[model samples]
Target chain A: MQVTRRQLLQAGLLATAGLVIPALGRTADNSKENLLLSSVTDKDDKNWWVLSDSQGNILAQHLLPGRGHGSARHPSGKSAVIVGRRPATFMSVVEVSPQGEYKFTDLTSATGRHFFGHAVYSVDGKFIYTTENDFDNGRGVIVVRDISNDYKVIAEWESGGIGPHELRMMPDGHTLVIANGGILTRPDQPREKLNLDTMKPNLAYLDTRTGEMLSKHELPDHQLSIRHIDVADTGRVWIGCQYEGMALDPMPLVYHHDLNQGGLQAAEASMDTWRALKHYTGSVVADNQQGIIGISSPRGDRVTFWDNQSGKHLQDIKLRDVCGLIPSPNGKQFVATTGKGDIAIIDAQTLAVTSESRTPELHWDNHLQVLA
Target chain B: MRNCLLILILLCSTFSHAAEREPEAYLKMLNQALKLIQPAHQLFADQAEELHNQIGQLCQSPSEDSLQTTRNQWRKTMESWMKVSVIQFGPLLENDSRLRIQAWPIRARLLTMGIKQLETAEAPPTLEQIAQGTVAVQGLPALEALLFRTDALSGLQQGQACAAAQTIAEHLIVLANTLNQRWQNEFGRDFADPVNTPGGFDTPQEAFDEYMNGLVTAVQQIKRRKLEDPLGLAGKPGKAGATESYLSENSRDNLHNNLTALILYLTGGEGYGVDDDLIAQDPDSIAVLVLDDRIKGITKYNKQLTMPLEALVKPATPEAEAQREVAESIFKELSLLNKAFENQIFEALGVTRDFNSEDGD
Candidate 1:
């Protein structure tokens, strides 16, 4: 029987109402290196689109719950899991055929609540890690699921932090990292309750298998929120925040971390500290290959480029409400999206807009995925 | 197998189609609501600003006469705001997105208070009025804050909220226990006489109705008492109001009971047998499904739902407003569904069955 993703979820729910118990396959961990790269609409409206790269062309489509706010390719490059946008729910598997057909299997709903940013597939491709908002209870839970059986949940963990939004599996393979957004809201009426009492963003590291919180590095209390994050191949994690509402007191914050004797210590700010950056960061991608890291703030209408080697702001591109940004597989082009749903392709080297496409049907084209 | 697959495809398609259509429908509904309220909001904002300035001036002068003048103006201004702001919840209830309706009571209360506070020396509001407004504004947000505190306290295990949520959970437990005792001591009858619903006994609607009304009243009283104490243990150092810590504790204690009362009543006498009629089947499942569908449906039915709310709240976009509307509608429907579900559950226990039937009638 070809069980649909929703059915799998329903069946799983029936098995256990309170806890999500996953269905495990016998050979679930067997290595399958065929990764699919196809752009399935995480959300639709043509102008605002999140694309997945196949060879050189971008396949454009919208997902039902909407486009992914974040996506991570499986190392084998055959499949990828995406963290789709709000009222946060599921992590969908974007399966690519050799022919490049996109089939999405609902992997797991956000146990923590709504998912915001990227979902990273383990380097071994055995598991997928993602972050989510636990709105019902007013916190965040970090969920890890096994993709072996089409997609079934394996284990789940909590961030021990409030509002864990984005996640990336560090290149170290053992460490699963998360951005613990420090915003507190009433569990039920999130809109009304914005209590900043115990608010403090943290970069949390956890064990992939045990779901044990290994280490937590907290940021200054003043940094509004640590939301989206990217981990470099060299094991450096770059973090970003969506400063507390439009009043510029809390501009977007970015910092790199180093594990030291006192624990994870924040490295000195690499570039001119961004003091006036407004609702600026939704996407952060650190390019290990190109030696540059990119941070895009669609609300700020700018994408700041940083020279990873020198730790400097190379340039900034203004794309209003820029939602997604990812390097092409060949490392020659950078693909990005705007809230208005425009796809701006820029040269990897010059970082200049080479071409732009619009998806009129797309409303909130959020994150991008690239299958190598 | 092929037929099964076909049915599966049909179900999936139906759901997706429903999903798409639901948001649009919600948008339409909201747009209409926005049209009805936009003029009023603008007027409310203007008048509110002016009254606020006047109140500020009165606060500076500090006299009974100035206070009386400010108070009188506040009352007049408040009356105007209410006239302009009172949402016809009937339309929201009837619309695809019922969740949006849930916030109306709360938001209405806040706006009312915003206008009320303007009268620097108006006659003190009756305890009943204060209690009602405070409960309305504080209900969901307070519960949520407690939940978040639970996570912090419980150490992020879904169970963490249990400790703080315990206070609320305990209250729920007490309500369930009391209702059980009432049935045993007085009625000594099965929750329902039994008509044909899935579960044999039903929470006699009368009993369930009384239970809910009394519960709201009792809740209001507690809130009033809470006002007297203000902070209790969680009181702030200098602030007269409750401290976050104390409020968290209070919410924790109270929320559990509320939820338990809700859950038990929703379950239809399966847990304690207070009223079989309250819940017929698994109230939780039914409530969740209904809430899910309503939320989804409201989003689809946006045209009717979004306009009025947009006009009222003045959110950034039609879609964002629609999202909020659907969420509200889901929660509101869930509250009603939850009550019904509890009635189903309690009815099975054959206790306090007829207590509330007349009230609804």
Candidate 2:
């Protein structure tokens, strides 16, 4: 019998209350339960992939060869892949068993390409698509890898712009929406931006089956590098930008693109709110059940929430160096992680911290993923 | 169960004891820093007002002496700004006031466009009109362009250009005055009494972290943006125009004032400071020792930079190459200072450096 997340949450609560249910314990294996996954750097500067429970307790951890960025969970719910940060050459695949044991397989980047720190698995979990940099050619490409064949490259296609950072498969499973960050960099220079004066960032929707570009929508300002995105259930694409212009210039850091409307609209916020974000948004996530979208500004040390339907600013919560954000397993709360080694569970409706924990030894990275 | 409870109580008391002592030290340091900061802002406002008065005289009399007087006042006002620009928190960051006061490494094209628009307007632009205009036109850079540039110096004599200069000076007075008043009033009181006002920090450690982060960022801006990028010490091609205060030829003086202010902040002028607290915590702290050494290194090299930074970067001249070497030495010392803060000082203080502040996407 398959157990749902709601059932597990209920069981965990009952156990916490000291109520003994013999049959429930036999059926629900506590060791197999996982809540969230993130890449963490310890005080020693070593990197690890950490899986934790809802209460922020570490369930399992595996060391990575290098620092990892965003992660993709397999549809089977038994495995996940961690990609290295920009100009990265390694990727690690982690498989977990029902007994809570973990296995790891590492993959190397193809010649003349490096991972841009994000990837998404196909709906069937048969293939993974990664955003990569064709640095020598000064272009971005999406490489399709077959999961069953040692994660080998099956095909490749243009990412519709220069520096694609993150991509997600739409609900339909065949459409991939990509955030082309639009800042060019060569491998020799690595993190230095090569094209700030003329960077044109865009949101591109591609037909995965035929490798054809469906539509591409560019931001109004060429200096706003579209870096991260999330798709709401209502078919709206939420974008987070890192501005490359003068720090004093006022620019909206969050935008949304509606598939039906076919253009990008800035999320409405006051000028002070825009300044408070400090011109960089590290992550964007949508809580469909709560009808709210969240954007984390690590530079501002705050997380801002917006109403998904209207694209209007709702509220702001102060969390020092917060960047990683995701919906809770029950879909009623936001599980946020901070670079200062904090994890907070925020009630979606009230926007208050219901619970929080700190691990002083570990610094969480930019993006968080549900373990599935 | 009784023994376990006893042990827990003992642990709690020990943790509480350390936590209680830290806040007191932080408050002392904060109070000293504010003493320096509050007065600096007032001087900045006063300097701006004097600059405005001098510009008015230049417009009415149209003499070179008055023009030179206004230019000298502008430099004094810019120095005041550089001293306090190291402050990266509180009212300075509240409404983009810092940018309105001085936007540096300015876009020449944008500044030209803004001045042209201001000069060619049908009527004299009001303070409200200038305030609502682009930040490029409303602050010190605009005033600098109007007062110092060869083509714009003529505008100080008469016509719409004189009107634009007077209007921008007026805007600077307002911006400077607002900053001064805010620091002297609620913000200053709240900073001094963090426990009662909370001042957006739950504990004194958080406030200290913010203060340290500001100092770290100031050092970074000095090294990377002000020196290395313009001087080509960081592997990028050198560009003289990239230097801050390039047109005013006050770039070296800007560095001197910034370093002096940083030293005041770290040593707390005449009162208790981070150095005192660190020594009290550990008499033989390595962080404090290394920090003082780096500070000495910066001062030594900074004094050696006799020429303006723009002239130092010009290639193929022996004197320019010699000056570049001096600038490079200062950059190296700054790099070490930044590392001491990130690695040693923060670690000694048990402050967790946030990853995003250090490395962001």
Candidate 3:
């Protein structure tokens, strides 16, 4: 493709300065005309906080645990799962009230000494699974517990990868998508060396019923580790990678899976395929309809747009280590939560941040979840 | 038409292909380095983990003797990793100009080394180890080639702390040289158009240069406006109420404007996004928007433009003789940033513990 002056200008700016400030005037056009995105702040909220559009005035919100990024809600929306990290990696199972208040009726996995609490509910909401790193041996495990009634320690599944970072419910009801990061680390220590030599990302589908490892796939050796996963509505998987290189280079990459093939396929087919595949990946998610996958790297400060079908690069936008990305309630917009803690909304079509909301408590705002 | 396009492409390609013989030597050297350094990075990481575990265990123990013993062991482990990482990765940048620019694995190794020391140190060491480690730790930053625009000095200090706690400012100047060389090399490849390069960049090179330049310039300004000089009102204006202070807020703001100009010029006037309107604001007026809570010196202010800042650090003791100490501290920080920046750039090119950036495709 012939390079346009605009493309050249943009590319030049991105390479030199490492930043892109969009036109600020776009924020005036309200995304949700009925519900003002302005009042979407979590005000001195104490016990329960949810992003709610309950009155149809805004999107959905819920009161999750104080450290919200570590938890995931079930696809069914019947129960909200929250992981608390202090004292230990603790999970609180709460019954969600219509008013967005969570009744704290249950807590699980509190006995462990150091729990780096990363948990997700099964598609059916019958089980709650989380990764717990044993501080003693530097080993990690995927604790599959029974939350059928409140929460209980049903079974524990060991993460095949050294540090299993996050999990998602694969479209096929039987499999749980797990990102087994190959970095061996103690709970207190930031991930030690990424086992680069024999490092293989354990992209596996564990049978939730038996807590047995069914199908597992690994990444190439040089890739430091795989940490995040987003399963599309169609059962395809988008995985985000981190800690591949230092801050200078691109933040590794975002990979997609052939729902049928069991391993990661090229996120985009053309253009130096392998080289592009290894950039540091971050949070990966499919939109509400699961048509497009959104991948952001705060380190790379860019979010790539991939065509869900052919896996072509439709476009990419310059943003920071966008640690967290979520589709708007309606899926017309993408809400990107940066590592610096600025929340921005990008139009699904234009792929531009239409609005931004910066909250005071934005330190390392890693993930964003829409409470039903 | 196809032949003509091909000829045009070939002619364009030749000028841009600076070191293009399949990148064989560079790739081979990188692969060899990865084979060696990947193990080293991992070993250091593993050792750091072990030390952290031991420290954790020691902290749990009620006995002071046990704690002291554990601290010693931890220090030993840290010293070992720091030495191996520097030795293994530092030489590559020193030896090869191309590697200096493209070798990310070496840089990744260095970052891991710094991270290993910082993370494993957990808390500041005992005064004795702190003293010893200061000498050892301070040198790591000087070895780093890539310097981050933000927190470069802090990163250097982090390296400095690991060295033995005693400041090593002189080594930092050397580090700055390495960083400048690496940046020039990488920037030349990543950004410069034929006209810009006096040599040309490949499509990928051109694209990457633009991308990095824009991204970096934006980040600098973002940090400047939001994190650094909010409005610039820092540093006393030079003169009395003659009219404007010697370093009037306007001048300080102007300094920020100048820093942006510097970044734009350095990056080929392509990457920066600060519009002309913002650039046009008086330097002193811009200087009035300074913020305190953020790190100082991250954005510079001067008579003309906001200078690109080094990492902001705690102000030193106030005394006339302290001038030497301040200069030493500045030198130390610059060295550390240079080393760290080089490491970051190397890693960005795809070189890491096990993977060389050049090996990707």
Highest TM-score scorer: 2
Q: What's model 2's lDDT at B9? A: 47
lDDT tens digits, residues B163-193, model 1? 2222322222232233234333322232222
lDDT by candidate, in order shown:
0.45, 0.81, 0.44
Q: What tier of docking accuracy does candidate 2 attain?
A: acceptable
Candidate 3 chain A TM-score vs. reference chain A = 0.74
lDDT of 3 by residue, A3-74 (tens): 332453556732342212221222434444322111111212222323322112212223344444455766
The superposed Cα distance between candidate 3 and the true structure at residue B212, in angstroms, equals 18
Reference-based TM-score, model 3? 0.47
lDDT of 2 by residue, A1-372 (tens): 233334534557424422111211111122233377888886656687766764555555667777899998898888888899888888888887685556777898999999999999999999999999999899999999998898889999999999999999888889999999999988788789989998998999999999999999998789999999999988888999999986466789899988858589999998778888888898899999999999999987799999999999999998988999998655678888888778777888899876676765568898898876
Tens digit per residue, CA lDDT, model 2, B189-274: 77777678746765667677777777788888888888988888867788988888777898888888898898889889789987
Show the lowest summed lDDT stretch of 10 residues, model 2 chain A.
A19-28
Give residue A213's error in model 2 in angstroms: 2.1
User: Which lDDT value does model 2 have at B246?
Assistant: 75
Q: Candidate 3: misplaced stretches above 4 Å?
A: A1-68, A76-78, A84-88, A92-94, A104-110, A113-117, A190-198, A243-252, A259-262, A269-278, A288-290, A339-341, B1-361
TM-score of chain A for candidate 2? 0.89
Docking class of 1: incorrect
